[model samples]
Target: SKKYHCTYCSKGFSRPSSLRIHTYSHTGERPFECPEEGCNRKFSVQSNMRRHLRVHRGGRPAR
Candidate 1:
């Protein structure tokens, strides 16, 4: 598989899209928003938002 490397953190990804998304960690861009009304939470990565949604579902915050 082709590997994409991040210029800022030296992390590697299999896809360019994944690397592009990972760049947000260094840039501090939160584009993903919680769909639940009035939550008002944003995340740079989609998985973070998924983890955050657990709080609204009565689950503990992700570690």
Candidate 2:
């Protein structure tokens, strides 16, 4: 079993990609943005961007 640890937290990951994603949590960098008109929400990852889109699709305000 291959186990990788994140330097920023006590969590461990089984893949290097997972560890890389976990590092972003500590950096607070938002590289993903919404493509909707008049929408300027940004997220640290694509997954979060998708989550935000869900809210917009549900007709909820982005806050």
TM-score of each: 0.66, 0.61
lDDT of 2 by residue, 1-63 (tens): 549988878689899988777788998877788978889988777777887886668955444
Best by TM-score: 1
Estimate, for each residue in 10-57, the C-alpha lDDT of model 1 and write its tens digit: 988999989989899899999999988999999998888989889888
Poorest stretch of ten by lDDT in candidate 1: 54-63
Residue 16 lDDT, candidate 1, scale 0-100 = 96
Cα lDDT for residue 47, candidate 1: 89
As for candidate 2, its clashing pairs are: none
Where is model 2 poorest over a 10-residue stretch in terms of lDDT? Answer: 54-63
